[model samples]
Structures are given as C-alpha cells and as structure tokens.
Target: MWNRLFNKKSSVQRKILVSFLGLIIFPLGLFSYASMSVSKETIRKKEISSSLKTLELIADKLNIMASDLTAISNLYFANSSLYDLLKPPQGLGIYEENAKKDFLIKTMINYKYAYTWMDYNTTLFGKNGFELHTYYEGRKIGLDSIKNEPWYAEVVKANSGIVWVSDPSPKLIPTVDDDHFVSAVRILKDFESGTMLGIFLISVSESFLYKQYGNAVQDYEQVLLIDDKGIVISAPDKKMIGQAISSFGERTNKLADESGHFTTKVNKRNMLITYDSVGKTGWKIIAYTPLKELYADIGKIERLTILLFLSVLAISILVSYFIARRLSIPIQRLFTSMKKVEMGNLSERSDVTGEDEIGELARKFNRMVSRIEDLRDRVSAEQEMKRKTEFRALQSQINTHFLYNTLASIRSMLMIDPPEKVDAIIVALVRLLKKTLTEKGEFIPIAEEMDNLRNYIRIQEARQHEHLRVVFEVDEQIMHLKTLKLLLQPIVENAIFHGIEPKPTPGTVLIQGELSDNKVWFRIRDDGVGYSGFPPSDTELDITELVLEQSAGMGLRNIRDRIRLHYGAGGELSVISRSEGGTDVVLSIPAIMDPEELKL
Candidate 1:
C-alpha cells in the first residue's frame, strides 16, 4: 500500500510544495522544542535560586535575634544587683525584705523598658520560696516546680551558661495566655564568687518568631524554623509550632544537610524545599514552595511557545503554497503545450515566455513545429508536382550552402575568438548538419529538436561579430513529446537575417512556447528592425492576408500553407510590428498526439 501510494510520478508542483513544507516546518519544530526545554530549565533554576536566597536571609535574621537574646542574658549575668536580689534572702526585718522585693521588681521593669523590642517575659526564681514575674505575674510556681521540668535540667546542665528551649511546655511557662512561646534559660550567678544565685527565664512570644520572617511567606509556601531535635519551633501556622518536622514529610530527613535545596513531596503535594542553618543555633530555617506554584511561570512560557510555534507554522505553510504555485504553474503550462505537439499538431507553438530553461524549451518547440509544417508543405507540393528528383537536388544544394556558411562563420571566429570556443562551435555545426541531413524521421522527440536548436544557436553566437543574444524558453515536459522535425532552424534564420541583422547595435531574439486551451502556442519576438506594413501589437491575423499585405517570403508562405493543410482552422500564424521597433511572430496548432486524432 505504501509503495502504491508513493509510486506514482509526482508533479513539479507537488515536489516543490513538499520541499517547502519540510524546509520550514522541520526547523521550526526543532527550534520550538529546544527553546521550550531551555526556557523551562532556566526558569526553574532562577526561581529556585531566588527562593534559596530568601531562605538564607531568613536564617541570617533568626541568628541575629538569637544573638540579641544571648546579649540580654549576658547583661543579667553581669549585674551585681540582679545576683544579690536573686540570691536567698537572709533572716532580716519583714519591712527590709519587702523593700528589697520592691527594688528587684523596679529593676526588672527598667530592663523591660530598656529592651522593649525583645517583647520577652522574664521570671526570676530565688533559692527560697520566692518567685517574681514580669508579664506572667500571676504565675507563682516555686523553684521546685522549675527544677522538676524537663527543659530545666537542660538549663542546669549548661554549667552557668544560657540554654535555648524551643516549644516550651505550659508547665515550664505558666502564662495567662494560651499563645505558644520559646524560652532562653540561664543560671544567675555572683560574678566575684562564681556562686550560683537563681534561675532566670526569658520567654519570647510566638509573635517574635512570626515577626522575624512573616512578611516573606507567600501563598502555597511555608517558612519554618526547626530546632535541633527536629521540632517545629516557629511556623506560619501556630498549630504546627510544637509538632515534629517529620510529620510534614518522610523526606524531611533530607533537611539534614547544613544548607541546600531539593524537591520532595510534603503532605502529599510536590514541593521545592530550601533550607539554611540558623547561626550556631543547631536549627534550620526552611522555605517550602509547592512545585506547581514555583514553576507557574514556566507553564505560562510553555503555552506561549506552543502558540508561537503554531502561528509560525501556519504562516510558513501559507508562504510555501504560494511559492510552490509560482514555480510549478509555468511548468504545467509548458507540459500542456508539449502534449499538444505530441498529438501531431504541426503548427503547435508554446507561448511560455522567459529567459529561463523552460522558456527556452518553449521557443525551441515553437520553432521545431514551424519547421515541420514547412517541411510537410514542401513534401506535399513536391508529390503533387511529381518533381521529387529536382526537389532533392535543390534541397542538397541548400544543405551545401548552409554548411558552407557555417564553416565560414567558424573560420572567422578562429582569428578573434578563443580556440576552445571555435572548437565547440565546430562541434555544434557538425551535430546540427548531421541531424539535418541524416535524420529521416518526419516526427521526432521535442527534446532532440531542442538539442538541434541549441547547436544551431551556438554556431550563430560564434558567427555573429556584433552583440546578438538569443533566448529560448521551453518546458521540459515537452522534450520527449513528439513533433515534426526541422521546424525551428529556418525561423531562427529568418529572425537573425531579416530582423536582428539590420539593427546597428546589440539585439535580442526571444522564443517562447506554452499550451493554452488544448492548443500549443509559440511566440518569436526580436528587438530589432521590424517589417514595414504589419500592424503593431496584432494578436491574430490570417496567414494569407499577412502574406499578401506584407509581401511575405516563400518560406513564410509555405509554412502558412502547411499549417492550414495540416491543422485546418486550429492552426494560427501572425506577424506583428512592435511600436518599440521589433517584430512578434506567433504560431498555434491543435493539440493532437495520435495520427487518427488529426483532422485530415
């Protein structure tokens, strides 16, 4: 089936159409694919890079806040008054003790005002049953309760240094509000004696964590702070603050890297996760962006690329079609003319006009058909008159003269022209004479006829001393098509001698042939001196009238009679005098390939 579909001969038009489509569509499709791939990766990388940078910034800010809290703790450790006040109160007057308590409360209030930005609550626990609070004033739980707490042990183990407690339990921070908080716990000690005094706790509200990077969070994105234990210390969603980070995703374990980014599924949704370590805190600042949201721009680009590719493809197809039509239509016209000539149309001429190969073929076809008509007429007259012997002698004499003239032309070229060109002209003349004298067939392929015409033209070019240009435009389709022999040479002879030879300057003879309306039409136009009496730009005229009015030569008269005898009313001959000082000769004949299809 494939062979059957593809085996048929393709027309020039179809081949051109397919070639143009391939040229445009293949490259366009490849370019579109490459651009989409590059653009997708580039956009994804750029977005990921930007997200990682933001995560790093969030980590840096958290480090800064942690440092500030540590600095505040150091201040408390340096204050001798704080150490003395936090130490156990010795036996003394009740009023004195009360005054000492008042002094301590005032000092705490002063420190709160001094660092209002920290927005932290402080609790001081003396060795005695004394507890003093700042914001959580009602929480009077004793030192025994604090020592029993899980995080309290972690603080004591720090050996007088500060310890950060994330996701603090309610018992550790018995505040009036239900808001979550993280605490910085440290031992208050005497600077001089190095004696431990009391435990100091600074509880930072959840607002502190959110406020640090709240504005950085976007829709469908998560910003989280996870403690060393992988506990969610801070997050946009308050409920998630105390939960294990692993609850978000099993792949969260990959966050073990000090700082990096990866793609994973979180809560069953694909996510792009970027993490950075908070400075010296053993905690991670992480950004979670849904992959869908992260690559949304890439999606848009994909759609736009497809749209552009389709648009360009559509335009390419349109342009290719027009180009193919332009290139193939002329060939089709020429093919039609060849078909007409093949059908025994002795007067058939191609009307295709151009300096291109196809145009040259048309001119050659027209000239060949004219020569055939003239030969047929001569043959018919000779038979009627019963003068075959005399006619043969006369034709031999004509052939001798023609060969003599060509030899003279070649001899003249040897002196002024190059040896190679003279040699080529000699070869052309030999071939032209051989075909003319030796070929006996009345009808020959149009291709052979055009080849003979080419040889004749080459000899003429070498023969002419002046600038004489001849252009023949004929279609290739008619090359193998049959036509009467010896058609083109005589007309070309007349065009050179009668038309171009008279012009003083350079001149051009154009021969064109094409098919129209089941008939082959040919035109021979020369930019040279035209005949005196013919009307300028004549489209149609009777051959007999042209012969009488213009006193046409025997060659023209014979060709006209032959066309009439062979093709009846379908054969046409016209001679026009151009307004621009030239001559236009046109010939046409019915398209009939088979002898039986002929009117005769």
Candidate 2:
C-alpha cells in the first residue's frame, strides 16, 4: 500500500506542492520539538531551584522556633524560687510535701501565663519519685513511669542541654486530651557541683511547628519534618506524625543527604522531592511536590507549540499551492500547444511571453510553428508543380505530331539529298527515340546528357524550315560530373522554339559547359528576340514563380524547378536578356562524381 501510494506518477504541480510542504514541515517540526524539549527542561530546573529555596526558608523558620524554645527552657534554670520548690524536702510532713507541690504548681502556672503566645505546657520530674504537670488540669504522675523510656535516657545523656522530642507517649510525657505535641527536654543540675538534679520538659502544641512552615505547603505538595531516625516528627496531617518517614515512600532513603532533590512516586502519584537540614536538629525539611505541578507551565508551552506548528503548516500549504500554480501554468500552456502541433495543427502556438525560460521556450515555439507552416505551404505548392511538370515532360517527349513531322521531313530529305545524308538523319531520329523512351535513373553523366541534347537538336533542326546553327563548348573536365538527366535539353528546346523559330532569320544557339567553383555550370544563349514575352530584362525570378507561372509549353520553368529540387542551394538558374537581342540562361549545379555525395 505504501509503495502504491508513493510510486504513482504525479503532475509537476502536485510534486512541487509536496516538495514545498516537506521543506517547511520538516525543519519546522524539528525546531518545535527542540524548543519544547528545552522549555520543559528549563521549567523543571527552575522549579527544582525554587522548591529548594522554599525548603531552605522553612528550615530557617523552624530553626528560629527551636532556638526560642531552647531559650525559654533555659529560663527555669536561672529561677531560684522555682528551683527551691523543686528541691527535695529533707524533713517535711505529708501536708508540707503537698504544700510544696502546690507552691511549684502555682509558680509554673504563673510562668506559663507570662508568655501566653508560646502556649506551652510544662512537666517537672524529680530524681526522687516526685512528678508534676502544668497541663491536663494539673495532672500528677510519678517519674518511675518514664524512668525506663528511651527518651528518658536521651534527656539524661543530654545533661544540661535541651533534647527535642515529638509525639511521645502520654504516659512518658503528659499532654491535654492525648493531643500531639513537640517538647524540649533538659536536665536541671546544680551550678556549683555540676551534679544532676530533676528533669524539666517544656511542651508546645504541634500547631506551633505547623504554623512555622504551613503557608509554604501547596495542594499537590507535602511538607514533613523528619527526625534523624527517619521518623516524621511534624506534618500537616496529624496522623502522619511519629511514623517512620519511609511510610511516605521508599525514596525517603535519599533524605540522608544534606540537601538535593530526586523524583519518586508517592501514594501512586509521581512526585519531586526536595529536602534540606534544619539547623542543629538532626532533622530535615522535606517537600514532596507532584511532578505535574512542578512542570505545570510546560503543559501550556506544549499546547502553544502545537498551535504554532499547525499554523505554519497551514500557511506553507497555501503558499506552496500558489507557487506551484504560478510555475506550472505556463508549462501547461506549452504542453497544450505541443499536443495541438502533434495532431497536425501547424498553426498552433504558445501565447505565453515573459523573461523566464518558459517564456523564452514559448517564443521559440511560436517562431518554430510559423516556420513549419511556411515550409508546409511551400512543399504543397512544389508537389503540385512537380505533378504538372512530370505530365508536361511526358507529353513533350511523346508528342506524335512532332514524330510525324520528323518522319515526313526525313522522307522529303530522302528525295532531295544523297542516301548517306538521309541515313545520318535517320540515325539521329533513332537515337533520340531510344534516349527519350528508356526508363533510367534520375542522375546521368554530363557527357550522356549532352549526347541526348545533340539528338534532340538534330530532330528539331530536321523539322524546322529555318537553318539552325547550334554550337557546343563543353569542358572535358566536367563531362563525367553527375547532373539530373534531360536538364539541359529543355532549355535548348526553348531557345529553338521560342527564341529562333519566330525570328525573321534563323539564329545560332550557343551552348557552353565548364567547371567553376567546384561545381558544373552551363550557359545556353540564343540570338533571337530577347525578353519579348517574358519578365523584363535582368529581373530576378523566384524559383516558385518561374516554375508555376512561366512554365508554358516551352518547359523552361520545369528545367529550373528540377535543378533546384535536386541540388537545393547548390544549384541555381538565372535568365538575362542582352542588349544584342538574345536571351542567356546560366545553370550551375554541384560537381558530384561519387554516388555518396547524393546522400549528403
């Protein structure tokens, strides 16, 4: 099917149109594809860079909040009054212990109200079995419940420094209504002995962390604060907190790097993951953005590219159509004219004209048609003249009256002259009959033509009542040259019948032949009435007029036509009437001795 479509023959216009479309479409398509690829890549990189910057900003904000929490936790270390209440009671009674616990609770409540914007809860655990909470309506617990917990060991390892914990068990770290919270825990120690004392836990609601970076989150995006253990510490979705970060995706393993981005699938949706370290926390600020969202602008660019490509293709088709028509129309005209010429309409011509090659061809075609038409007319006329000339030549050769007159003249001569003279006349008559009646080739040697002419002259002289003096001066060098048979006989016949026969006195006919200019020429003259019934003296005669108009019974025009038709430009005939009262006819023909020259 492909071959059938492609291999079929197509017109010039269709081919040109297709070629133009190909030229435009191929490059345009390549450029569009390249541009789209570049644009997509550029947008992706820019989004990645921008996403990384957002993560960094969120990390900075989280770092500031962590610092503030650490500073607030440090405040109790400097408070001697809170320290006195937290100290172990050496000899106090049950009521006194209760009274001291009440005093510590009141002090923590006052401190909590001091920084209401912080909205934090406090938990104090003594190295002894005592514990107190400034949250959950003053709920009290014992430190024995958290003594074996993993975070309890972290707080002791931290010594006087702060330890950040997120979403701890309510039994280990108390909170209101089992709500999620992040806490800063630190050990309280005596400044003088550097000896460990009770533990101080400062807890803030999870909303504190969320509010720090919540505005940076988007609908198709996720933001997570992941701890060093790959645990999600804080997130907009409260349930995700305290879960291993790997629960989001296996690609979370990449978060081990300090900073960078990678692509992954999260919840069956492709996503671009960007992450950065939060200062001093061993935690990461990880942002998960859907791949589609990161490259959203690329979709718009792709649509625009398709539209532009279609527009270019449409314009190219239109332009190609116009150009094809402009180029093919003239050639189509020329083709139409050619078909007419092929069908024998020689008058047909292309009318297109301009400076282009097609126009030049059209002009040449017009001239060619004109030339062909003229040649056809000339050939048609020549054919008619040749038919008439052949018939006249046959009639002249077979005239019974001329034969009877010749025989009668012989009989009269037999009575008046000697037998030898009579025999000579009879021999001339027999030779003339043999030469005229024989079927022979079109060309004969000059010597043979001259012999036949002598035979004809003898018969004419015998038939005429006047004395006829005919002279021959033929050159030996041209005697064997080839010429059309009976060429000279008709001219000599005209000189006798038309030039001398009507004269008051018998005239002499002079016949001369010689080689000139590599050709054979003959001169036939008669000293009798010159230009009496012909065109004026020395007036040039066209071959057509001489053959068709001047070809009376004399046959002078027939001889000229035969010469011209045989030799083309190599042969010529001219007539001149002299002041001395005689007519001269000069005939020139190619000196062709070889048969091969005939083909040329």
> Which candidate should be chosen as best, given TM-score against the real structure?
2
lDDT of each: 0.74, 0.76
RMSD of 1: 23.7
Residue range with the least summed lDDT across 10 consecutive positions in model 1: 539-548
lDDT of 1 by residue, 1-600 (tens): 434333458777777777787788889889888887887678678867887787788888878777877877777777665655665666445686678777877877887788777677777787766677875666477787657677877777797777778745666456624367777788876666767677887778777878888888677788888888888888888888888888876455687788888888877888878888986567888888887887787788878888898898888878888988887888898888778878877766777899988788878878888988899999878774653454344446546756776888787888899999888888888788888777375456677877888888888877785568999898665565555455556567667767787789888989787767877777778888665455555443333465435543445554565566556687887766666667777777666565346736
TM-score of 2: 0.57
Worst 10 residues of 2 by lDDT: 539-548
Question: What are the per-residue Cα lDDT tens digits for candidate 2 across 1-600?
Answer: 434333557667877787788789999999999988898788778878988999889888777767767777777777664555556666456787787678777877877777766667877777655676776545556677667767878888877888877765577444534467777888887676676768888887777777778888677788888777788878888889888887666555677678999888888988888899987677898888887876687888888889989998988899999999999999888999999999999989898988999999999999999999999999989986885577456446534534765787788887777888778888997987677656665677888988988887876776564568899999999988888777787778777767887888888999999998898889998997654466444553423344336534346666655666666688888776665577788888889986469546
- Per-candidate total of colliding backbone pairs: 30, 0
| True-vs-predicted CA distance for residue 281, candidate 1, Å | 2.4
| Reference-based lDDT, residue 92, model 1 | 44
